[model samples]
Target: MIARSQRERLLEAAVRVVAEKGYGAATVADLTREAGISRTTFYAMFDDKEACFLAAYDNVAEALMRRVAKAYEGEERWPDRARAGLAALLGALAEEPAIARLALVDVGAAGPAAQRRYRAALQRLTPLFEEGRDFAPGGRSLPANTSRMAIGAVAGLIADELAEGRAEYLPGLLSDLLFATLVPYIGPAAATREVGGNE
Candidate 1:
């Protein structure tokens, strides 16, 4: 097998170490050791532990976005695409709980840069949420910031599950999350049917 790049190894190691030790406690030495690379190699790719952690966070977030986007592809309806994307995301988190925690939890404490990156990721998702606007009641329209708030609320809930060591239970929240996201636009009666229709 071909050997992995030093940068990839370092990023993977950073995700594992940061998830286990938290960004504050994890060190460059720990990252290099976990990656099985020399300190020189780590420095060659990243300026410091924070930089490596930020890179890892970006990688994780990008990977998740790709999965969600792919799942949303070829779907005619917004609710169908939303369900598909949620399933893809929850499935990914289930398979990579450590990286999930690293991206969702540890990144916040890593530094202001990481926090900004997290906020950017959330902002980027607003359009995905906004796509459902046409499904809302004819006269009832959501506010401009409603998408961000819904995304933030769901992110907060996912963070709580990860914090409680119940990451595996995240998929179970899909219906409720989907309901919460679409309810404002679709209204209760339609939203209830949309959420429960899948069952």
Candidate 2:
């Protein structure tokens, strides 16, 4: 059986190759050569280029989630945790530009498998915001409908910012946008204070 480490190496190589050459132009042969593995080993690990792309997408998602989790640690308030998590996510995008492109942009090009993976990632992440609903001040809560809208808004904003080459400024911009949106529930005075304190 192939080692997990070897699989990771191949996935990493695939990410780099795909980011450079794009999905249509990237080949399993290119990935295997980049990973310094035999074609047989590549096939043993992944069924095809599409399968490999899915694995690479999973890898990027896991890495981004871990960064977010780390950033959320030690924050007792929900708003603070949300801001920190979003900031960490944006930071990851800045640090790993390929992952931002893969997770947000190129994902659509990867077909159904990638779409499922993206949805799953968003589902897993939703709980973090849900957990912080009480932190909106005065025991205010986020309605389920609004929460979904907020999540979609934030994701779309980040994706657009990354595509526009403003990824580095996304954390602050996202935080302000979310804070403003939540101000009605949390109270504009309190929300402004929180944003000012955080900034």
Candidate 3:
């Protein structure tokens, strides 16, 4: 097989295998079999199963970030941008339950390395939510961890939905997730109004 194709298939298989079996149970053999690649090729691409899973996790996280960032681009206001970004995120997760599971749920079981990677992946979205600080009324005075807290809230909400086997219903959570994201940056009254304003 072509090198690039095998690599892509391996990464895709990592997502599928890990999502189906969970990180602890998924083995290198399973990844290779799922990818239709040999052990040698798999080793050539990655050091081991964890390495492969990490690569796959990063791949999905980066793509999801790109989608949310793209959605936020044209909206004029922070609330609108937040709505657009959260909608994009929820819609994407809903479209791929395996990805939803793998990204938010499976990685936690993968081990310390994977957990660190997951945390780092969540951190990458900081800039997206950080923009809300400048948009808020007491922008500069909000808690130092405003962006991180909002990110955690958003991630936690999505993780709960995914853990409950409600991936397909994720898109419908747009309002709730938006409120969680905006409430800290804005406030309850304005956040509630913004949540209802667009619907």
Question: In terms of lDDT, which candidate is strongest?
Answer: 3
Give candidate 1's error at residue 191 in angstroms: 1.4
lDDT of 1 by residue, 53-109 (tens): 888888878888888888877576898888888778788987888878777776778
Two-way TM-score contest, 1 vs 2, winner = 1
* Per-model TM-score on C-alpha atoms: 0.90, 0.86, 0.95
Please give the distance, in angstroms, between residue 124's alpha carbon in candidate 2 and its true position after superposition: 1.8
Candidate 2, which segments miss by more than 4 Å at Cα? 137-142, 180-190
Candidate 2 residue-wise lDDT, 23-127, digit = tens: 888888899999999999888877899999888878878888888888877577777777778778777787877667768877777788788898777666766
**Runs of candidate 3 exceeding 4 Å displacement:** none
Clashing pairs in 1: 136-185
Residue 21 in candidate 2, Cα distance off native in Å: 1.4
TM-score order, best first, reads 3, 1, 2
Candidate 1 residue 20 Cα shift, in angstroms, is 1.4
